[model samples]
Target chain A: MYIPTYEDMLAAHERIKPHIRRTEVRTSAYLNELSGAQLFFKCENFQEPGAFKVRGASNAVFGLDDAQAAKGVATHSSGNHASCLSYAAMRRGIPCNVVMPRTAPQAKKDTVRRYGGVITECDPSTSSREATFAEVQAATGGDFVHPYNDPRVIAGQGTCSKEFMEQTDGLDMVVAPIGGGGMISGTCLTLATLAPECQVIAAEPEQADDAYRSFKAGHIIADDAPKTIADGLLVPLKDLTWHFVSGHVTEIYTASEAEIIDAMKIIWKHLRVVMEPSSAVPMACVLKNPEAFRGKRVGIVITGGNVDLDRLPWLAAS
Target chain B: MYIPTYEDMLAAHERIKPHIRRTEVRTSAYLNELSGAQLFFKCENFQEPGAFKVRGASNAVFGLDDAQAAKGVATHSSGNHASCLSYAAMRRGIPCNVVMPRTAPQAKKDTVRRYGGVITECDPSTSSREATFAEVQAATGGDFVHPYNDPRVIAGQGTCSKEFMEQTDGLDMVVAPIGGGGMISGTCLTLATLAPECQVIAAEPEQADDAYRSFKAGHIIADDAPKTIADGLLVPLKDLTWHFVSGHVTEIYTASEAEIIDAMKIIWKHLRVVMEPSSAVPMACVLKNPEAFRGKRVGIVITGGNVDLDRLPWLAAS
Candidate 1:
């Protein structure tokens, strides 16, 4: 297995600079008081596709050679990665295809279609998703972009922490929510070389704590299915992502489902940004373990803003 | 009635610079395509107090003489103005008193208290609010800062349009939600001097279309108690605000309750920002009158972000 270097991250930043948004770092005095720390939120939720996934998707799409580009790119994701990859492909005028679960939200499906991505629906199980994706990739002869495990994708995600470090000075720690470990792996890749003194922490929902358990066991632990309000963070860690997470992550924290929902409401009330449930886990972690973050300058990556408007977690019957 | 000059707006900007936020202007490709017009959103919902009311409230709180400053400031708003004024006064370490209807959302009442303002509850009636405010003023000897009917407040609100004009070039029209006409009046005051070529428009809920009626009649038409989902826009226009409204407004457009809710959902889904119902009116108007706004560059002011999270208008029983 090949490891992506800091040099690759630098090249990815240069390549994907104009294609993705340089999302601003936002702060809230109210949130500061609640957490007892000076917090800077790197608002990836403000990205064009409303997620940091755009960075990796754009990097992979733009790096393809003319011959490979003609065949386009293919991905199997039921979330932001699918729509974001589609958006990046559309920007370059290439044909893109997505294999999505039939149970995925209609809004998410519509977003992918709006970006001109052809969607092939599969059953809601993991085996079915992988089987369907294989068939589609074989038929289309397109470049396959794994959401988190690909070296190019990880290098692309590394640019987020690079920009965060440059956007603010003297960050004591950085926290991000982890699912498939894509964002956390990217943070580790950048921080390991650029600012080793700055701690990198990963947060996860307790209901879906495979990453936390994997960290404790010092090995990759796969969860076939995990139930949580944070739909984005249900996937277990892959080998490439686990390599970075196990080596560079300082700590892994977990928050309960109720606490995550409460944190989401607080962010909406104070920060005035619409964030999905998955994006609130890091804040919930910070709030729950104040001593770890107290009096520290903390940078939190707000992962995404794509949400089902009619079925907000707080509004849902729990 | 005395008019607030452009010079007064400049002075207010200078005085409130340290206290208020210079919110960024955001654009949406989806919204532009939907309306067939280039749209720029002035996101006042990102303000420190989560509303543009803080700009005016801060100006009023800071501009007081030493003697008046000792006495602090007072108001009778059941919405954003009350809490924003409290936040401004707390920043100055001055006394802030508010006379509010007891029936106002508990979240709003809590916000006022959180800012260290003393709340005086009154019956949910216009006469009761006015009468209770007079008694409180007499007892506290605080300077009364009428929410939208004061020159200082109007001048402070005018700075938003000035910043909008500087942020985005060549806006053909500026649209803002009108309640007591404070924001629309400020837009008129600034644009009438700085960008006379830009048409100024006001949007209101059809159920509480007092501003539209007053604009048509060439006189102020007071509504004692208008029922609308836009709680912040239920108040009638006053003499000072009407002066700017009658003289400078290009058009007053009204949207139905359903239309406002639809637009609010669209903004939350596409823009990924939490905006209150009143703030959604301008976008609703643009959607309803695409022909009036098509093929033009438009600026829309997002007024505030204060809402009862539990009782969203769309979730309310119809």
Candidate 2:
């Protein structure tokens, strides 16, 4: 198993600092009152690509040598990673190819295209995605950058926690929504070295709690398909991500679908930041486990702001 | 004639700096591409009270002497001003009384109460509001703070444009939505002294085109009851606001209700910020009049983020 060191994150920061925005850290007085915790929100939703995936994606794209970069970079994702990778590649003036499931939202597909990505559609299954991506790689001769399992990508995401430490003082606990364990693994990688005293917690949806089940079982347990409002957190943990999750993360908490939606609306109504359902899972954990967070200074990492405006979750029911 | 000097705005900035957030100026790549104008959005929607009115409201609340502050402050507004004034008073630990139209949305009324404002509902009419306000003042003995007509409030709004000048370089034009003209007057007050070369423009909804008509007629034209999606821009300009509007404003532009809603969706989709309909009129103007704004850098004041989430205009139509 390849373990990413703190120095890798430091180097990643130097490599991607100019390309990615050091998104603002904000506080919600109402949220603070509700949880009885001084909550500082790391707003990665404001990132140029509208997500924290840009950090990892940029690090991977820019770290490649000229000859390798000329061949271009490719990723297989149906979420923010596809657009973010494309955005990073565009910034570096490199070609980017994305293999997305045909079932992906048109908005997500449009975002990838807007960032100058060439998209190839595939069946929404793992075998089909792998086969389609392999064929595309053969045709384009592109470097394959895995969404979360790569050490370079993990190191790149570690840069976020570094900024969090610099932005706020003395965070007793840090929480992030676990979606294939990319963000949580990066948090584990950083907090382990810098502030081991600060507990690292992973939040997951109850309807799609593969990470929680894997954590409790003390091994990797892959779920074929789980349905949740948090579409981003449906993917199961990988080997490298599981390594960090098992060793460094202190706990994994889960929230119901109703709780997640309520938290999402609360952030919009009060904080007024346009974040997605995945971003609200961590907040849902904070609300559900109030005793664990009360009187503690907590940092919640807002993962992304990509949502379909027309089919908003609250409006669907109303 | 009570002309607000630039020095008063400087003073207001000093007094309210601790209380108000120095909102960030964000550039939208998509908005730039859509309008052919490099748009710099001053995001006052990020304010704690979800609006720019907090700046003026805080200035008024904090400017009061201890004896005057002891009696508290009062306003007759049905929108952001009511909640913002209450927020400012809450911060200063003083009483805030708001006489609002009973027809106002419950969400708006709830926001006022959340900030500890004592609400006295009246019939939806100028005469009824004024009459009810007088009775409330007699009962509570609160100092009446005019929403936009007061010199101190306009000076407070001026600080936003002052910050705008410092934040960006070489803006050829600055635009803001005009209602009672608090924000427009403030923009005029600051830019007239600081960047007189930069054209100051006001945008209004065609349905509620009192400001546009007032500009053409060279005097204040009060509208009895005009309906539009941009509800915050319904109020007509007062004498104090008219002074700055007639003298310093370069032009007044209007947009149809459809254009305003479209512009609002674009901001929410591309900018990923939760701003209200009133804030979208300026962007709509830039879109409709592309010839005037094309290739020029324009600063747009995003007035507020207070919206009734359940009753979204587009969702209503759907």
User: Can you give the TM-score per candidate against the true fold?
Assistant: 0.98, 0.98
Stretches off by above 4 angstroms in model 2 are none
Which run of 10 residues does model 2 chain B get worst, by summed lDDT?
B308-317
Give the chain A TM-score for each candidate.
0.98, 0.99
Q: Candidate 1: which pairs clash?
A: none
Q: Write the per-residue lDDT of candidate 2 for residues A32-80, one digit (tens) a residue.
A: 9988999999989888889999999999999999998998999999999
Candidate 1's error at A128, in angstroms?
2.6
Predicted candidate 2 versus true structure: per-residue lDDT over B59-177, tens digit per residue: 99999999989999999998999999999999999999999999988888999999999999999887999999999999888988888999889999999999998999758999999
Q: Tens-digit lDDT track for model 1 on B65-184? A: 999999999999888999999999999999999999899888888999999999999998879988999999999999999999999999999999999999997599999999999999
lDDT of 1 by residue, A1-318 (tens): 888999999999999999888887888899999899999999899888899999999999999999999999999998999999999999999989999999988888999999999999999987999999999999998899989898889999999999999999859999999999999999999999999999999999999999999999999887757899999998889999999999999999999999999999999889999988999999999999999999999999999999877777888882
C-alpha lDDT of residue B11 in model 2: 98
Give the C-alpha miss distance for residue A167 in model 2, angstroms: 1.4
Cα distance off (Å), candidate 1, residue A250: 0.9
Q: Model 2: clashing residue pairs?
A: none
